[model samples]
Target: MTADRLQPVLAGVMLALVGFASSFAVVLAGLQAVGATSEQAASGLLALLIAQAVGVIWLSRRHRIPLVLAWSTPGAALLVSSGAVEGGWRAAVGAFLVVGALILLTALWPRLGDLIAAIPTPIAQAMLAGVLLSICVEPVRVLLDRPFLVAPILVVWVVLLRVAPKLAVPGAFVATLVVITGYLVDHGAPDLSLAPQVVWTEPTLNWQAVVGLAVPLYVVTMASQNVPGVAVLATFGYRVPWRESMTVTGLGTAAGAMAGGHAVNLAAITAAMAASPESHPDRDRRWIAAYTSGWAYLVLAAVSTALVGVVSAAPHGLVEVVAGLALLGTLGGALKGATESETGREAAVVTFVVAASGVAFGGVGAAFWALLAGLVVHGVLKLGRPSAPRM
Candidate 1:
């Protein structure tokens, strides 16, 4: 193969590696937070990988665009904040199914998608920031108590941020693995199987899971991932097919839900690299990068179980350091988006505080409440202010 052909394949391979390595820990943490057992969480990771692979391959090839799909990282972070829902893991699975259905509904009804888009950017970003605060503090929290465990992770991340910013989280994750390995080796290995297995749970929906889990999950995913993904591709001169992309991702989310995956959607932050001129100077051929990413996800999926096994065994709060570190970059972006507009600053601050409080009322989670509070503040503030007169 010529250099051009090989370049995209390599770029795709790196995309998958960085994407998966940087956030898989957060995925696991979110699953466990929502009541998944270690094995179930591992299964969820595998399901998400397969769903992403299928979505990327189908959409990129069919549309002849470099379309990448991703598991919703913000949605996962929301799960971490929401914690265990009513009826435990099965209900959480039910919520995942609901998210998929909601996504499909959005695809069929453009109005529904528009409604999600209409959510104030500050409110949406504020909600995400609030959800991330708890997790983002872990490195500091652990650093004070177990500096030996977390310091190395932070040092590696800091070094990489300067040398190769894109690789920072992945580098931190590698450091975490090293620390965990040494701890495990010194303490003696536990008898555990590294083979990942698909564990299907029968889903049962309840109001709590739907309101607290599904609704918030759906909102975060659409607002953070799908919207940004479209924008990113547009900047690169590729228009994503909205209806088709939603359909594929919606179906992918539904298919993976039974195996415990949360949500799968369009890639945003990582989309630029794969779609850039760096992948290929010829714009039309850049789809090769996305297509290659699908196969790369499959290869990475092979080790999902092993990763879960190792992290699950690591001392409490230790593995979580990696997940927390993974979210810092995202937290920064969310905070910036939330605070950017002066008009919405007060409402956004309200939303962030409520979300950061991690409070639940009437069985619904903080994310839902935070949105309601922000909207109310936004509306009331609007009513008292003067409107610009028509020209």
Candidate 2:
């Protein structure tokens, strides 16, 4: 292949690896938090990878755009903090199905899309920034808790950020690998099979799970994942067909739920990697990067069991530190977006504080509450003022 083709391919692979290495542990922890066993968690990872691979390939081809798909990281974090649901993992799967159906319905109905779009951009960004705030602090916490193990990673990440900003997180990831390898060598490799497994669980929908998991999952996936995903594509001049992409991802989420995975949607950070001009000089050819990433996800799926084992074996807080480092840039961007406008500044700050508070009511997570609080504050403050004329 010519260099033109090879560059996109390389970019695709880089994005895939970065995406996987950064958050696979969070995915596992989220599954376990919702009551999944080790076997079930592996299956969930496999299912998510396969579903996203299909979605990415199909959407990239259909739209002829570098449309990347990902399982919702914020949703997973919500799950992690959601505690166990009433019906256990089955109910969680049911919630996943419900979330997927909602996304699909939104895609099929323009009104639903409009309703979500009606959410103020600053509020959404604030909520996302808040959701990410906890995890983004892990590197610092880890540094204080296990300085010997984490200091090198921070040093490498900082050095790369100053000299090669694009590779900063990837460098931290490399440092993590080195640290993990040493620890594993000292403690003995985990006994894990190389082959991937698929464990199917029946869905059980309960009001508790639906209200708690489903609603929050849908809101965060839409506000934090899909919205920013579209923005990333738009940043590179790609006009996203939002509805079609939602439909594909929603379907993928539903399919993955049967195998224990959570919601899959348009990717935000990784999508930028694939859609960026650096992926391909010819804008029209960047779709190749997404396609390549899809295939790479499939390859990762084939080794899902081993990947889970490696992450699962790592010391407590280590994986989170790496994830925190990987997401630092995203957190920075979200914060900037959240506070950029003076009109919504107060509402945005309210949203950020509420979300970061991690308050849960009626089993629902803080992200939903944050958005609600922001909207209320925004509305009340704007009550006596003239509404900005609708465009």
Candidate 3:
């Protein structure tokens, strides 16, 4: 292949590596938080990888757009903080199905799609920024907590950002691998089998799980994942078929739920990696990166069990620091987008503060509340404005 063709392939691999290395730990923690055993957690990761691989590859090929897919990191964070439900992980799986069905409904109904689309861009961006603010601060927190291990990683990331902007995150991944490898060698590897297993958890829906998990999962997955995902594609001038993509992700999530996975939606941060100019000079060909990323995800799924084992053994804050480093660019972009417009600035700030506050009301997460608060503030302010003079 010519260098032009080869670059996208490499970019795809880099995107996959960063995606997995950064957040797989969070996925595991989320599963365990919801009362999943190690086997179930591994199965969930595998299921998610498979579903995202199929969705991303199909959508990118069908639409000729770099449409990357990701398991909802924010949804996982919600699971982590929400604690164990009464019906356990099975109930959570049911909640995942509810979210999937909601997304699918949004795709099938034009009015629903229009309503979601009507959300002001600044509010969506602010909500995303708020959702991500906590995760974005981890590198600094890690620096203070484990400077020896995290400091070099940060230094490497900074140096690469200056000298090779495209490779900055990939370089951090490499540094992380080296650190992890040395740690394993020093403290003998954990005794864990690398066998991939598919665990099916029958969905058991309850009113509590529906109100607590289903509603918040749907909200954050839409606000924090899908909305920003579309924004990322638009940033590179790709007019994505938003409804169709949502439909595919929704179906993918439903399929994954049977196998113990959570929501699968369009990617936000990693989508930028695949869709950016650095991935390919010719925007039309960036779909190649998405396709390659799909294949890479499938490969990762094949080794999901082993990957989870490795991450499970790592130091407490190590994976989080890596994730934070990978997300720095994305966080900066969200902050900039959230504050760029004067009209929406106050509402956006309200959204950001509410989301970052991590407050929960009636078992629902702050993300949903943040969007609602911002809209209420926006609407009230608009109403207070004096009517324009008649023509």
**Model 3 alpha-carbon drift over 4 Å, by segment:** 1-15, 18-38, 62-66, 74-88, 206-212, 223-243, 268-288
lDDT of each: 0.93, 0.86, 0.82
Per-residue lDDT over 248-308 for candidate 2, one digit per residue giving the tens place of the 0 to 100 score: 8889999999899998999988999888888998999999999999999999899889767
**152, model 3: CA deviation in Å?**
2.5
Tell me each candidate's RMSD, in Å, in order. Answer: 0.9, 2.6, 3.3
**Best of the two (1, 2) by TM-score:** 1
Better of 2 and 3 by TM-score: 2
Q: Which ten residues in a row have the lowest lDDT in candidate 2?
A: 322-331
**lDDT at position 373, candidate 1:** 96
Clashes of each: 0, 0, 0
The candidate that achieves the highest lDDT relative to the unseen native structure: 1
After superposition, which runs of candidate 1 have C-alpha atoms over 4 Å from their true positions?
none
Candidate topping TM-score? 1
Give the least accurate 10-residue stretch of model 1, judged by summed lDDT: 188-197
* Predicted candidate 1 versus true structure: per-residue lDDT over 241-286, tens digit per residue: 9998999999999999999999999998668988999888989988
Q: Once all C-alphas are superposed, what RMSD does model 2 give against the true structure?
A: 2.6
